[model samples]
Target: MDDTGLISRLGDVVGEANVLVAADAVAGYLVDWRGRYRGTALCVVRPATAAAVSAVVRLCAQAGVAMVPQGGNTSLCGAATPAAEGRSVVISLARLNRVRAIDAANNTITVEAGCLLQRVQEAAAAAGRLFPLSLAAEGSCQIGGNLSTNAGGVQVLRYGTARELTLGLEVVMPDGELWDGLRALRKDNTGYDLKQLFIGAEGTLGIITAAVLRLFPWPRAKATAWLAIAAPETALRALIALQDRFGPALTACELVSGVALGLVRKHIPGPHPTLVDSPWHLLVELSAGGDEASLREELASFLASMIDDRRVADAVLAQSGEQARRLWTLRESIGEAQRIEGPSIKHDVSLPISRLPEFIERADRALVEAFPGIRMVTFGHIGDGNLHYNQSRPTAGDQTLFLAAQPQVNRVVHDLVDELGGSISAEHGIGQLKRAELLRYRTPLEIGMMRAVKEALDPRGLMNPGKVL
Candidate 1:
């Protein structure tokens, strides 16, 4: 279809007021949040309802124009960004923000695609439940994007990833047919779980309209502690011991590297007074239904035993809830600190919990040996074996030269991740950034199967083309 004709059709679907055509107005939606990729779109369309989204998708599909689905545009990868070639229209789901229902009895809350992550959290909290998907970008990220990426956060040790937290989804297929499979059933083994297809598709297969998310009972008591352990291995041991002692009460077990902490101190401003300098620090939290004193006592006893056994060198328990939030603030600040330091090669890979120690040791040694004077900032949910293994620019070198080595660095890191029966892309889905790497790492059969599914669903390849498979 001609450019003029295409714009006219899209305007009809979402109205002219909601269609953005000015270059300056569409600039922010063109590039990704991390500036890793920059793309072009003919226009940006904001549809407030699923019906409008379907109409927009159908119009674009008929015009042979690709459609890029965007939520909060908080992707670390370029998943939400459109292609550089101006043959697509970015369908921003920001206008579909609404809380449809909250069923406390079923422990579920249904929300539209545009609802902010923090907003959903607040809504759940107000309803006396916890959303449990906490992340650094919670304040800005959208629930649809979170589900699309299947985001894993600090609480994944207990609550699981966004995929697991989601019970059902309402998506518009590539052809613009609305699939209303939003039933909050705990057991449905009737056929293939269709919702799983779009959950982590990164908007390639379809646009997610809304989701039925699982909720948990709000914790009456909470406890947090910072432990200085000998190594990641010790942190792992302590993690198991805490689980054995507290069971489901253990909410979060985050591993922090001394290098990661130092980055925060050097790059980020202000005093991180609650932070304890150690080779490795573990931020542990317990969400319980009993008294706070009992929760603290349980965690303190576990840490005391670890300290006596030499697994921990030092430890500090949060005296109050405010102190606990302070401890968490430091962990959340690591990403921002690194961002301020400047751009670096970031990898969100995951390995088996048992093999995490070896993966870290080998990957660290390999990267350092291959590239001298490289800085390794490692920290993540060690309990779930997902590490945000990132490499900082050399202190004394050309920044572009170091950044240019991304391919080699990814080869080294991703090869090891594949060798250890681990995933090259963990919480962060394979958007455009890792699309080529995904083809190389994933087997041809697997790739063919993914392609088949994509072809079957998006026959014309109009839904987020140039993305995952």
Candidate 2:
């Protein structure tokens, strides 16, 4: 049980090269992606297989030491980082990266937890399929972390979140037992959906080692367009109109604020005059199985109708694939632009589609009233009601002073989300950053149920302690 014996046993399980103890070596695992949290660990363990992960977990459990499961270290809310006590061993899944199988016939792909999301997408594409769960961090974030957080991305409107895309899971329980429920069946109406429990648990009960994800037929034809809308309400109405006309053909509908677009234009260099000056914009796209020319014509017809009806003020349709990518570049560059500006309070919340405009109106008014000159850079998957509502300090204000008002700003925004029957933590799981907020918003009975589940699965709380429940 001593530190020396523990390190030796871990080294024996996974070679000494895989067991990292030097401060300089494991320093990256200490802090989170946003640098908002920094925590020390006893050591870092790299396990390349599910069996090895189980062995390491068993050793840690016997020694009464906790294990923090980490992948890619891309968590925006400090879910994968360790604690300051340095009592736990961080298990890095990076070495486990592998594509187990690609079942094109069944429209599924089985992959290891360490496989990068972008890699999975490429594998699916190679098989003539589409793995639609995508985010800005797709290049670096692993599938294990994505499933653990139940990530929602731009394509959730057409496909779904990580939870819905997952068909099966292979998990290492808290007691170091491997549960291989990696079945790729579509209809299994047997017992409880056990895999669902770990999908959004944030590694509180168990560590995910592999997963089977659903795939869709690759779209042969596509159309991308940018519409200048008057406001959020107008954008919502336009979305409704498009859905009524195109239905499932409409793949993505993203809402971006003028302020957010301006940030991208200022910080990142790219195409100029992406859109005419407008208070709000919608980056709309459609995918179809028909001819490419027909798809473009349909989208053009729809946009023409929208403009005639005044639902859209102005618009620009991409004439080629390169132009489409350029338009997407504008939408995706907002996050990096905000980061380049400075630190700001970020809120990932969701609301009823009908209530999104109201939530924005009320929250924006309240924030500006409370802290005058505050810059609200708002944009997200409007098709799904999830908004990345963030705030930046005034140009003349002090950064530290602005950050000190986070709690107050959160209250103003979250209160409105609650009043509108919305989720304070929409796509992002309740990592250490939002633990207190989770307790505040969730009812006592709900919290009690979650606690009971956690206690049942991880009695000793040796799996990712101080996270989630």
Candidate 3:
């Protein structure tokens, strides 16, 4: 498709300088964060407002050209990356970064789509409320991308995913019409909940321009702890005990394998935690609106009990805010550390909480038998049954040769994921990376319903084509 006319119109709507056509200017936007997918874009446009986004989309629709909505360009699944074959326009939402409103009484924050997740969290904190949606990319990832992917972070055990925290969304439909559904009400059952279609659609159905997000009371005190555990089963026992004792106060439960933690220690440049011998570790946190000392004392007591039962080999409780942050840094740095270490096959799968031990035991044995000397860097929000089970090269080899086994590796992991009655994707949406896997795992009827909605909203598929469905 010829994008010259559409390009000029987009420039007119968003301003001439906002339209970037130079290869160097648009090169960074065409590639995903993981350096996995690279594509071609005719031009990159920066729209600062919802109106500009609408006009740009309309122009693209009129010219029969495709558009890709990009925010922060931090998509691990290449959802924000354009198709390598198509001359699509990349709509960069970075210019729309703004906090539009914060209703403290209503406990809601209305932010433009391009606002970073960290900024939203800061805004909520400034209002004495907490926007609990967080992840490793929160520092760079935009709220629009997070909503589009339905991001789940460490605190998901308590606050839930982006879809749950989101109250409303303002979307730019594929036909260039803007739908202002930014209602912050908790209960609104008038008709079809249109926002749900666009949230996790990964911009295939529409482009999310702004959002009204739910907020919560800020935790006055929090106690963080790290446990050296023998196995996933032991972690599960500790998880159950924490849930029974702390209940809603149990905010985060993370599982980190020794190899995964070693990567963070070796590459991330920080003092690693003291528990070095254990093969598996659990990082957990409890937050409440109470005194700090009492909370830590309670957690310490629980840790002692866990040790007595031999479920925990050792435990380290954070003594101060700095200590707690250091503990969190360890859990959050796994992804970056993995990137620095080398290329690996990644899987973000979820299973029934009760079946996690069995899934891990079976998957590990199966993978080792298939690919000898393969390194499994496994960790995730075990509280929510999500595991970031990744496999890396054993010691040293051509990166290309190791990566060639990706398809075969995925089959071994994903086939077992299917057999265990688990989902292939838990947090990340079916972006380009998982599109084929999505088709292979999801039932035909479920996919049909999804396609029906996509067709109804984006008939020509001009909005972020070649992504998701």
Candidate that scores best on lDDT: 2
lDDT ranking, high to low: 2, 3, 1
- Tell me the deviation in Å of residue 40 in model 1: 0.3
RMSD of each: 1.2, 1.0, 1.1
For model 2, the stretches where C-alpha displacement exceeds 4 angstroms are none
lDDT of 2 by residue, 294-376 (tens): 89988999899889999899999999999998888888888889989998899999999999999999999999999999999
Which residues of candidate 3, in runs, are more than 4 Å off?
A: none
Q: Compared with the true structure, what per-residue lDDT tens digits does model 3 show for residues 1-469? A: 3567777777789889999999888889988888999999889999999999998888888888899999988888999999999768899999899999999999999999999999999999999999999798899999999999899999999989999998899999899898999999999999988898887889898899999999999999999999999999998988998999999999999999998998888899867657656899999999999999999999999899889988899999999999988999998999999999887889999998888999889989988998888898999999999999999887776778889989998998899889988998998877899989888988999899888888888888788888887
Query: Candidate 3, which ten residues in sequence have the lowest lDDT sum?
Result: 1-10
lDDT of the candidates, in the order given = 0.90, 0.93, 0.91
- Model 2 TM-score, all chains together: 0.98
Worst window of 10 by summed lDDT in candidate 2: 266-275
Candidate with more favorable, higher TM-score: 1 or 3: 3
For every model shown, the clashing-pair count is: 0, 0, 0
